[model samples]
Target: MTELSHEGERLQKVLAAAGVASRRVSEQLIAAGRVTVNGVVVTELGSRVDPLVDKVAVDGSAVQLDPDKRYVMLNKPTGVLSSMSDERGRPDLRAFTAEYPERLFNVGRLDSDTSGLLLLTNDGELAHVLAHPSFGVTKTYIATVTGTATPATMRRLEAGLELDDGPIAADRARVVGEPSRGRSIVEVTLHSGRNRIVRRMLDAVGLPVVELVRRQFGPLHLGTLGVGRTRDLTRVELGQLLTLSREPGRPRSGIGAPDAAGTAMDDDESDSE
Candidate 1:
């Protein structure tokens, strides 16, 4: 792009800006012989693009800057895997997107078995920032545990538990709801993006998270949005998120953790890795 100056820019940046894939992922698409410039395979990372004149294609569809970016929040039900596509032919988010005009990918993730709030977007840069651990987006979840969590256990969790990866700590946890009568419900909130951190955290303290549901992430909440449905975020909502991205007080980890479990929707966490 620097070389082009008054002419074409590099292809990878253009694709990333177009909400296709991350720059790294775009490079893979280019190298795998999936991308072409002006109908010619341009596998070279140095391939430049003249957006005004040259056409880029991936899998035969022309890639260009979409006029409008889509950012949606969905109450994802269980069964959908966290992937753009599934090789095993399992059902995915595409089923809920029949009316969508542009292709969008999930922002964070909801594992195949879990269900709850999921963000889908065509803005790769925003996705990159939002999903980055450094941003420390707090996620609130209601987890069904095998047994009641005692004060000592809660204190241990808040202070930090010794996990294989490291001492896993939560910002908050408390049980204040009813579910199935005898069993206690707890709500937990944390900012880290460790693999199955919520489930793992509960497991280490002798409380197994039987069912995990993410009710909130950062500035967004799983309000009245029904399961399997979605809606776009307002501009102001997006502005708040952007503002959060610029804040420093929000630690990279432990930014938000609620201590309790109840009244939260399940979510797919398979994509967290």
Candidate 2:
């Protein structure tokens, strides 16, 4: 019998962290005599191995540790649920991230009817910081509202409105473009992650939203990413996100400064429930 190393992580945890399988399933694999460490079969559940140095394998196949974490930006298309899988077989982020070997989950959610700038990651700690409201991660959205957005309506949104859950207010709200025939495009930014908060806030102020899209989250931007497409964030981009997560109070603007007409960029589009 090989002596288990006290300094290294448990074998099952290393396997699960590498995205091989869940911890329970990994234990089963070990009990079945399929797991080997440094060429020795390790059926003992308490067996530990240095992931960086150990030659871990399953059924003669070497298992490499995926030490580097992944952060992905997905331009979510409407009608796809913001989940890894669905019990009712609905389309989800998995369909787009099927090629990635890592077990990734959405950092936050976008309603099935709403879409844009959804993030997926395997880094749980970073995901938690981004999703938590205390971190003050701001999200910016451009909404197409049914009613003409006069200055009073913008004031109402910025001042605050009562919702079924609680009071919500926009960090900023301004007209994005010229209102045409009672329809106007408005840009709003806030930190609330309430379900359908954007749509509900507009409705509360008597400006029913016809469409909405998140253009920015924290320091990340959607930036012309085509709908239904996904891409990995660059090292620099990932570093910036980490830095922002550490300093929660830092302010983040949309793609650019508000133009002379006070219009923000119409980066993407979506319909809401």
Candidate 3:
């Protein structure tokens, strides 16, 4: 049992407010030795914690105590720019974010033509690390390309290719099915954050992309979320992302200037796709 300070809200009450469980169930969870405060086992009932200050976890997964933080996943549709606002007056993410009271900004970016999972959040720390190319968060895409993707092409993609910007390689690549009607579906996974990297890599391998959709980002997946729709991240998904953001070798600071919505934008205008 951990000692509680005289100040702050009750531990179970905080957990309940965080939507972890009801106040009764939260007390039961604490009594079961499944909760921790500041990395210490905190089984004592009636323990107090500053929701804004103390780090809390249940079953080794961090709990999001601050209510101000919001994590949203949007299945961005094609023809929409990843930016919240586009100077050219093109369709952008403003329509998706309009419902959320918290000012949310995209974590990274996707090209106007590519579509799928896009993360919008007000959590600057997680956004900074995930969007930073140095951290190397993996993204998976399903692309329909103009040519048949043979095993040789898959091998070449995995083996790597030299692009105009630099040398790049897919962490994983494979054909989803046999080619038909002059096009094939190929899945590629890479940690690179370069602009239009998937399309460029496939083109280098002689498979020019006709259509592309991101299937996954880090631990979050597009799942069944429809295009042009958005949903809040589940507690488990958010926990996984937070863990990834704090992994070893993550930079403590330095991404770029925060936009109006408080997201860290990379110095390079086109680093994300």
Q: On lDDT, who's better, 2 or 3?
A: 3
Where in model 2 is the C-alpha error above 4 Å? 1-67, 248-273
Instruction: Assess candidate 3 and give its TM-score to the true structure.
Output: 0.90
Predicted model with the maximum TM-score: 3
Off by over 4 Å in 1: 1-67, 178-180, 247-268, 271-273
Q: In what order do the candidates fall by TM-score, top score first?
A: 3, 2, 1
Model 1 per-residue lDDT tens digits across residues 143-185: 8888877777778888998889887789998775654644667
- Candidate 3, residue 135: Cα displacement in angstroms equals 2.3
Q: Positional deviation of 206 in candidate 3, in angstroms?
A: 0.3
Backbone clash pairs for candidate 3 read: none
RMSD of each: 13.5, 14.7, 2.6
Residue 264 in candidate 2, Cα distance off native in Å: 29
lDDT per residue (tens digit) for residues 175-242 in model 3? 99989999999999998877788888998988999999998999999999998999999999988887
Task: Name the runs in model 3 displaced over 4 angstroms.
Answer: 1-3, 254-257, 261-263, 266-273
Q: Which one wins on lDDT?
A: 3
- Cα displacement (angstroms), candidate 2, residue 73, comes to 0.4
C-alpha lDDT of candidate 3 relative to the true structure: 0.85
